[model samples]
Target: MTVRSLYLAPVTAVFPAPARTGQGGAAVYEQQRNRTSDADDSAARADRVVELLGARDEVELALKASLGGLPRERDETLARMAEVLQATAQGLALDAAAVWADMPERVLRNWLAKDPAFAAALRSAEALAGAHGLAAGPATTPTPAMVRVAVLALSRGATWPQAVAVAGFPVRGFRRLSQTHPVLAALVEAARRARPRKPKNFVPAGYRPRRPGQAPPGPRAFRLVRREDQVLP
Candidate 1:
């Protein structure tokens, strides 16, 4: 116990710098990835999203101006810019949705319910809440108008909501009429018992012919699988 003790002093002399070796230059490897995210874009992007939706400007301007300096905007120049812009605007392009002109009324209706800005537009229009009566659902399964629309829509090839709108019934106040119309009750019973439609065969995507501008695809384009008047093979 009266022996010696080792000093805990630090080593001051540096070793040969270890030949400056450690998996080569990790700096270059780490820098390989692009670290830019949308958050890094100009501070005005939020304003741009709202502005584009309101100004009703072409999507190209929105993409170029709003997404300026972003890789997607640059890469999109070579492809179908409209399609690309549209996809980006679907969920995040809150205001741009107004420009989806071809979207059906029923689809727009549902979207308005889910989107606050769109819902605000409906509120301003004063027709958003009960416009389709779906929020309340139906205490009873279906009313006369609902049944009529349902059968017509289902039979004539419309979506459920499409039939609801096309038949022109107040979805909310429908119960009021349900008691007045017995046929509607019967129609629901019929619809509930009716057979469901079969799924149609799909046209393969890659099956193009050698010739360009060949007379456009016939009835298939119109979704007419086989008409009685169609010339047979």
Candidate 2:
């Protein structure tokens, strides 16, 4: 057989390709780029969420450590309350946490009052929430409704729950709002100090007022009356 040489054409010469320089090509490129950017953004957000959750977990651990040396039942109760507080800090409403925990909101409030550890945990959780931007912050300019509610809270001598109930507002929302808002918190504090005070010259009911410079009445002697039904002892 005679020697023969075979030549092969370049792949690009054999298969001509369309140019990708028109609006259609640009549109496809832009779409793909947007998709990649969106995916990256989603991943970053997921990582941030995980970091926040881990921080919350650390708060819980610290809370548990603080609750040490308590009675078993009390420790459990405080732990539960801490969990509720953390949930609230993470955007769950206080009333909703109460509902989820199958208890009345008053119980939670009372726990906060009676247990200092629980209260501390609540403060920590709230601070964490604020730091992490999880909790709502004070408004730049409060709305009319917010002002009205705040005024109502300030004007009442009743407890927060009672005042909020009378105002037809949810106690949890009002409490959270007041805590986050400086003006509202100040108003609430003023309301707390607004308890009725007695006048300087006030006298007890059923007691006669003494004349000026008159001596106060002395203590009376006690006398026992004999019972007719009792036999002589």
Candidate 3:
């Protein structure tokens, strides 16, 4: 029986690390240049794909808007918008609204104006997001803690929408909750008038004449409380 030992050159020795001169250097340079070209090509392709996808999304949104392709009922739309606005973080409601509803901020704003519940939800969300430094955005699933915070905010002069911003609950859902807990609705309603608003058109209360440069005595001129003679529920 014969014993044999096989020896193999190490990769470093066989390939002999490229020197910074002549053929070795030229080969290394060519390899690097090819890699750079390939990378540039890949990057360009990726950018083109991204651009195309973005354009497709824009086109789809435009078509949907023009065709009134919203899938939910009007009330449902409002509720969903409220939920997204409430749950989303600050500085992101506009983007969130678009993503959630496939509608532009301008269109959503128009709806918000016409829908008190939606407006309230948005305002509440903004309030909560600002207060908690949660301006980045909403969680995927709203926690019970978030709901509790929203409820507390509502009780503390925050509107339903504003309070529920972090709750991820819909406006209608909050309304239903309010029904079971009347205090919630009452508190929100009361908070609405907690601060007096200036008279419209700069007209003073009791139709009194105002002098030029007068700021209509500010909001303090009028009391927010109802009169004693007014009937109570």
Give the whole-model CA lDDT for all candidates, comma-separated. Answer: 0.36, 0.51, 0.49
lDDT of 1 at 217: 45
- Give per-residue CA lDDT, model 2, range 58-160, as digits (tens): 5644665575642344444545675677465654445545533334578788877877777787777777766865553333333433333334333333466
Candidate that scores best on lDDT = 2
For model 2 the local lDDT of residue 126 reads 70
Model 1 bad stretches (over 4 Å): 1-150, 157-159, 200-233
* TM-score to true structure, per model: 0.22, 0.28, 0.30
lDDT of 1 by residue, 113-169 (tens): 665654554443333324544222322333332343344343334454544544444
- Those runs of model 2 whose alpha carbons end farther than 4 Å from true positions after fitting are 1-72, 136-233
Between 1 and 3, whose TM-score is larger?
3
- Alpha-carbon shift of residue 27 in model 3 (angstroms): 6.7
Clashes by residue pair, model 2:
none
Judge candidate 1 at residue 18 and give its lDDT: 34
Q: Lowest summed-lDDT stretch of 10 residues in model 3?
A: 218-227
In terms of TM-score, the best-performing candidate is 3
- What is the C-alpha local distance difference test score of candidate 2? 0.51
